[model samples]
Each structure stands twice: as structure tokens, then as C-alpha cells.
Target: MIEIRGLTKSFHKHKVLDQIDLTIRKGDIVAVIGSSGAGKSTLLRSINLLEVPDAGTIRLDQLQVDFARKTKADVLELRKSTAMVFQQFNLFRQKTALENVMEGLIVVRKVPKEEARKIAARHLAGVGLSDRMHHYPKQLSGGQQQRVGIARALAMQPKILLFDEPTSALDPELVGEVLDTIRKAAEAGNTMLLVSHEMSFVRKVATRVLFLDQGVIVEDGTPEEVFSRPKSERTKQFLANYYRDQEPEFTI
Candidate 1:
């Protein structure tokens, strides 16, 4: 299980997160939904020490870290236990898809070249990129490139996976492929925390949903609960605005 308490971050005196607390069970796919600048991405980044929160305690299973007093080793251990996929596919321009996926394994994990190659190839195929393995990032479509990012994260075999608007950069036609890959990972029982604006996708794939607004999680429950019977006015307004074009029920 993953537990977060008193998570707080500020930027030039502007509080982006305020004492955020939540728990994610093992193998759960929890989607964080909110407006822009709602602290969703910061929360995910904080988990891996990317944003360096001003105050918080992060506990992943038995390992724990206090953000205020985290050591270098603690940061390293936190990163080793989690992997993040960004909104933009951050593959190296100089590397092929296969190399991009294998880079972490060979460099960070220090796996033998042959072993890393095999592991990378398997994950690339898992994301339906076996045919694009030898292609450079520039040669792949946005969806294909993001799939490589997913393959790279999965190849790490981290205890938890964090996705920050994974499909936000893709075109409408390309979004489905990346979402499908995430769904496959969810089916395979990967623990995931996702920040996404795709309500339909979240309703379909997320085991739990969090509605964050203005630096706080206003609602947390099963997808059905939050989407169907949200208890917070902020959540209701957000969802209503997000799904204004849909049916009155917003039952995607």
C-alpha cells in the first residue's frame, strides 16, 4: 500500500498543495482528475521526489520518507521504487525505441547489455511497439513514442507507476492507442497513479478516482461513486463543466 500525509508544496509563496493525504492500495489504478494547476501533477511528482515538496511523509509499503528530512539515499530508494511517464514522451532524440527503453536498465539498473536488450524488447512488444523497436523517437508517431515511454517505465519493474497526463499531448486519433496500453497494464495488475483529463478513460480503467481542486482532494471514492454521486460541490462543478457536451448523467 502507498500512504501520503501532510503533503504540501509552495511556489514563491503560492501554495500548490496543502496537506494532501491519500492512500492507494496495491494493484489499484487511481486516477487524479482536476482543472489545470490543481496540484495533480505536483502530487505525482512529489511521490518520486521530483517536485521536492516542502513538507510530507510518503510511505510505500514498508519504506517511508519524510520530505522535510529526506536523505539522498532516501530519494534514490524512492525513485528506484517508482517510475514516471510524462505528458510528452521524453525519449532521447539520439536513441532508437529499443535503446530508449533499455537505457534505464543498462545505465541505472546496471543490467548486462544482453539482458537489458531482452527485457526492453519484451516490454516494447508488450506496448505493441515491437515493429517500431529499431525506429528513432523522431520517426515514431506521438502515440508510438508515448508507448515507448510506457515500455521504458515498465521495464524498470518499479513497485509503483506514475503517469502525468500521459495522453494530453497526443492528437485525438492517437490518444486511444496509448490509453489502450495503459488499460492493458491495469489489467496486468500494475499499481498506478494517473493524472488525466480523459474522464471516459478514467471511468473505464480507474479502480478509484480522486477529484482535486485548488490544491486539495475534494472527493475520493470508486469511479462510480465520484462520477455518479459526487459529494463535493467543487467536484460536481468540475465534472459538469468537463462533461457539458455529454448526456445529463455524464455516465461515460
Candidate 2:
């Protein structure tokens, strides 16, 4: 379980997060939804200590993460249990798909070279990229490269995966493949915290949903409760505009 209490962050004099408290159970897929700059990305980074919090505590299982008291060593250890995937697929341009996935296992985790390669192969296959293992990031399509990114994260065997707008950079036709892969992972019991603009995908995959506005989570509940019956007017208004372009039309 992950528990966050009184979490707060600021940039210079501007606050990006304020007194945020949330709990994520093991094997749960929680989607964080909000407009741009609403602190969704910042919140995920704070949990992994990538973005230091000015105040508050983050607890993962029995491990306590106090950003205020954290050292370089402490942050490194915390990151091993939590891995992040960015919207842009950050793979090495010079490396093959398999090598890109194995980079972390060999460098940070210090696994043996041969063993890491085997593990990398398995994960690449898991993401449906077995044949593309020899391909470089530039050689593959956007969706394929993102799958490589996912494989790289999976090879780390993190307890929690944080996705910051995973499909935001993909073309419309490519989005479904990445989302499908994520859906399969969630079904197979991978704990995840996702920051996304895709409402329909969130509605289908998330067990719980968080609605944030102005650096605070205004609504938090099951997908059905939050999306279909939001308690706040801000949430309702946001959803109305968000789904406006996607709503179907009928002709008499």
C-alpha cells in the first residue's frame, strides 16, 4: 500500500501541490485526471522523490519517504521500488530495443550482462516486440518505441509504475495499442498511477479516479462515481468540455 499525507510542493513562491493526501492499494490502477499544469505530473514525481516536496510524507508499504529528510542514497533506494514512464519515449537512439531495455538492469540494478539480456528479451516479448528487439528507436513507429519504454520499466520489476500521460505523444491510431498493453498489465495485477487526458481510457481501466484542480484533488472516488456523478461543479464542467468533441451526433 502507498499512503500520502499532507503532501505539499512549491516552485519559488508558487505552490503546485497543497496538502494532498491519497492512498493506493496494492494491485490497484488509479488514474489522475486534470487539465494541463494541474499538478498531476508533479504529484507522481514527488512520490518517487524526483520532485522534492517542501512538506508531507509518502509511505510505500513499510518504507517511509520523507522528502524533507531524504538523502541521495535514500532517494536512490526509493526509486528502485517505483519506476516512471514519461509521455515521450526516452529510449537511447543508438541502442537496439533489447539493449535499451537491459540498460537499467545492468547499470543500476547490477544484474549480470547475460542474465539482463534474457530478462530484457522476455519483457520485450511481453510488450509484443520480440521481433523488434534488434530494431533501434528511430527504426520503429511511435507506438513501438513507447512499448520499448514500457518494457524497459517492466524489466526493473517495480512495485508501482507511474505513467505521465503515456499516450499523449502518440498518433490517434497508435494510442489504442499502447492503451491496450497498459490495460493488459493492469488486468495482470500491476499497481499503477497514471496521469492521462484520455477520459474514455481512464473510465475503462481505472479502479479509482482522482480529479485535480489548482494543485489540489477536488474529487476522489470509484470511476463510476467520479466520472458519471461528480460531486463538484468544476469536475462536471471539465468533463463536459473534455468530452465535447468526442460526443456522438444524431440526425433526425
Candidate 3:
């Protein structure tokens, strides 16, 4: 389980997150949805400390960290518990798909080269990239590259998987493949926190939904609950605008 309380962040004088509180049960696939600059990405990034918050307490299972007074070891422990799959498919330009996945095990986890190779190959295959394992990022399609990124994150065996607009940087045609990979991860019972603009997929894959506006999570519930009967007017407006071209219901 994960618990966060009084989570806050600011840049210059602008508060991006304001005393946010949230919880995620183990194996829950929670999707964070909102318009631009709604603290969606920042929330995911903050859990792993990519964008450090000014104040908060983040608890993952038995581990907890106070952002206001986190030690270096605390930061490292927090980072170790979560792995992020970024929007841009952050792979090593110089490495092949297998190498990209293996690097973390070999470098950070201190696994032997041969052992890391085996582990990486298994994860690559899990993401349906076995044939592309030897290919460099430049040689793979955007979707395939992102799959490799998924494999890399999965191989770490972190407590939670954080996805920050994993398909936003991909071509429209390629988005499905990455989303499929994430679906497979969910099927395999991996806990995940995702920030996505793909509302349709969010409804399909997410067990829970969070709608953030300004700096707060205005609505939180099952996908069906939030999408079908949002209590907050802002959430209803956002969804209505998103699915304006479709049916009155959230078919898309």
C-alpha cells in the first residue's frame, strides 16, 4: 500500500501541488487524469523524487519518507521502490534494447553481467520485444522503444510502476502498442500509477481514477464512478469536453 499526506510543491511563487493526500492499495492500477499543468506529472514524479516536493510524507508499504527532512538514504530508498516510464521513452542512445534493460541490474543492483543479461532478456520478452532485443533505439519504432523502456522499468521489480504520459510522445498509430504493453503489466498484477490523456484507455485499464484540477485531486473513485458520476463540476466539464465529439456517455 502507498499513503501520501499533505503533499505540496511550488516553483518560484506558483504552487503546483497543494497539500495533496492519496492512497493506493497494492496491485491497484490508478490513473491520474487532468488538463495540462494540473500536477499530474508532478504527482507521479514526486513519488519517485524526480521532482522533489517542498512538503509531504510518502509511504510505500512499510517504507516512508518525509519530504521536508528526507535523508540521502531516504531518497535512495524511495527511488528504489518506484520506477518511472517517461513520456519520451528514456532509453540509452548508445545501447541496444537488451543492454538498456540490463544496465540497471548490472550497475545499480550489482548483478553479474551474465545474470543481468538473462533477467533483462526475460523482461524484454515479457514486453514482446524479444526479437528487437539486439536492436538499438534508433533501429526500433517509437512503440517498440517504449516497450523496451517498460521492460527496463519492470526488470527493476520496484514496488510501484509510475507512468507519466507514456504514450504522449508517440505517434498516434504507435500509442496502442505501448498501451497494450501496460495492459499486460496490469494483468500480471503489477501496481501502477499512470498520468495519461488517453481517457478511453484510462477507463478501460484503470481500476481507480483521480481527477486533478489546479493543484488538488477533486475526484477519486472507481473508473466507472468518476467517469459516470463525477461529483465535482470541474471533472464533469473536463470529461464532457474530452468526449464532446462522441456519445453523451464516455464511449471514448
lDDT against the true structure, each candidate: 0.94, 0.92, 0.94
The sequence of per-residue lDDT tens digits that candidate 3 reaches over residues 1-252 is 999999999988999999999989999999999999999999999999989999999898888899999999998888888899999998999999999999989988899999999999999999898899899999999999999999999999999999999999999999999999999999999999999999999999999999999899999999999999999989999999887856665446
In the range 146-239, model 1's lDDT, one tens digit per residue, is: 9999999999998899999999999999999999999999999999999998999999999999999889999999999999999999888988
TM-score of each: 0.96, 0.97, 0.96
Q: Quickly count the clashes in candidate 1.
A: 0
Point out where model 2 deviates above 4 Å.
none
Candidates sorted by lDDT, descending order?
1, 3, 2
Cα distance off (Å), candidate 1, residue 34: 0.6
Q: Which stretches of candidate 1 lie over 4 Å from their true place?
A: 247-252
Give the Cα error of residue 101 in candidate 2, in Å: 1.0
Worst 10 residues of 1 by lDDT: 243-252
